[model samples]
Target: MDNVEVPDYFICPISLQIMKDPVTAATGITYDRESIEHWLLMRHNTICPVTKQPLPRDSGLTPNHNLLRLIQSWRRSTGNSPGAAAQMDKRKTQETSLNQSHIDKLIRGIGNPDSQLKSLQKLEALAIENEPRRKQLVEFGVHNAALHFIMQCHRGKNTNASGLPEALHVLYLIRNSSNGLKLSQMEDVIGEIIEAFSWVLGCDGETLNKTHAIFAMKMVVRKAKSAQLRMLKPEFFQKLVDYVKQRGNKQGINAALQVMLDSSPWGRNRIMLVEAGAPFELIELELKSPEKKTTELILGILFHLCSCADGRAQFLSHAAGVAMVSRRILKVSPAADDRAMLILSLISKFSGTNGVLLEMLRVGAAAKLCLVIQSNRESHLKDKAREILRTHSNAWKASPECLNLPTLTSDDVC
Candidate 1:
């Protein structure tokens, strides 16, 4: 069997193994059932591995019975022994059996100053290998150990500690696993973890470390109670804002935006973020025309920030803020359109000075609102766009740009 040449097409693109249960994706690529399921479901990936086409999480997998039969026939013709299959099963059983004790040992090693780095590397590798391993790590409270290690490094001023990044990566994997890490019951522990993340974000570690740090921080912020979120230090927000302004890695930027959005529901946190100059940085970030999801996140946060007078002042302070929000209408996803419209609605209602309203016309924002009214967006969103146009139509309708738009009506101005 080892020397036999297997058909290249018989191998799974993900696991690179003989196709045991071959299934075809919508993209017309065949992969092993387990491998593709893990890729789509466990890893939460949306792109087909072979075709790089959009593969939704709920996309059906059609079983390739003919290919399965061919592979089985090929295996039988190659005289693949039953003993080899038994050995493979035994190895898998051994791996499953060793996980608990192995994780226990690693957790103990994380406490030891000398073996911390090596232990973290092993744990990180295990966590990355598969979802089950990550769930096991979370079950064994490895996230706690990882957090403890990070806090220790923070206290010891060990910014350069090799284990710090590995520990952060491990924590992120566990937190992001299908069976997410359970929230720590102790408020103090949660606070300490938040502090540890703050230090990691501000530290001069590798960019990868800060990236993982922000990802983990996002999860923490999401799980944190309102009181806990409100308790966040000013420096925490400053660090996140600085990361945004500096434009860290793409994932890091999104995570930071999510963190801000999650915390923005609390008025105090909103004020803190606005005070940190988040509005300016977010507008600057948006002006660069980020990806769809990133744009949604940025617009979502801006929508929240715009709720307050100070936030609105900060958002309106940017010359392109209103224009950017207007441009995203009907151009990005439905979510982006929703948030952008909400932002425009807020500015027009609360801060609609003649100058601001006229600027909205000058920047084509009024024209965009008219487009939204005619767009195939959700009825509620279309209604929202119509309302914005009606509320400010007197100012917008007089403009030649808006006058030419067929959707603009006398009733649009209230």
Candidate 2:
């Protein structure tokens, strides 16, 4: 093996080692998949390493099957026999078993105060390391054990404990990995998980830990049944909105917005979030978020918030409320169009005042409604848009422009 000189073509450009899983980029350059993912996803590079061509963050990597087969053939021809390969594979399994044994010892020590933190640290490393180990951890019931550890932390109010941070981080990684089994309310641990998240969000901690806390709750809420979601208290909603207002990190904000959406199915959660100043934060986020998906999320949450009286009040209270909703109507995707219209419909039907009508007209809300009716839109959306326009036609007619605009009838709206 030492006498064999590896071909330069078999080496990864970035890693300078034999490629394990070679993947070709959009720029037609080959690289090791793990190395390229680290460069593009973790390091946040927008260009190919070798070609320097623009590579989208979400672009797929094509497996270099030909190169992989060639590498395998070369290895087999170079005195790498079946028996040797089998022995190497057996050794690898033994090594993995030894590693898992050490991890299991640490897991058992988690109950001991002196070594608990160190154990949790090792578990976190294993959980976060790579895909195979994560799957192994799941198979070993680490997720369940971590939940118990988290519950202990929650009950003890040891939010600042070193072990709890690692436990939360591990739980988050497990929740995200596709290989991990789904958690449910039937397990009777949902409440404990929520409490753990609340502690992390409300208490002071490292930014990374807090970020993981927000994402963990997001995953928890996304997976929880409607009954479990309804069981969440107002404080839960309040903390989520407060985290959004705090705007700790970009990923955390995204997770908070998603959690808000997930929890919005329960009517009380909507009001609680409104009370927590979610509408204001959402409006601010909408104004700031230029991404289509993020803007749609903000608008979707805003639509739910606007359904309730308190939510509508909070939404309208924002100076750019009507204007921002109006601005997104035709500019973004059709889904955005739907959400924006629903929000405007709520305000126009229940919260519309003369001043509000004039504000709508001045902010081009009236014009957007006209565009919705005139454009190729769904029948219901057109009806709502026309209803909005006709309901305020008399007041809007005060503006000469509104007077000259085609007068749409109730029948037309219907």
- The TM-scores, one per candidate, come to 0.78, 0.76
| lDDT tens digits, residue span 298-377, model 1 | 99999999999999999989999888889888888989988998999999999999889888888888778777666677
Record all residue pairs in model 1 with backbone atoms less than 3 Å apart, i.e. clashing. 390-412
Q: Can you write out model 2's per-residue Cα lDDT over 266-329, one digit (the tens) per residue?
A: 7988878888889998888778765688788899999999999999989888999999999998
* Native-referenced Cα lDDT, model 2: 0.77
Off by over 4 Å in 2: 1-103, 184-186, 400-414
Clashes of each: 1, 0
List residue ranges in candidate 1 displaced over 4 A.
1-76, 79-90, 185-187, 398-407
- Evaluate residue 73 in candidate 1 and report its C-alpha lDDT on the 0 to 100 scale: 87
Question: Positional deviation of 300 in candidate 1, in angstroms?
Answer: 0.5
Which one wins on lDDT?
Answer: 1
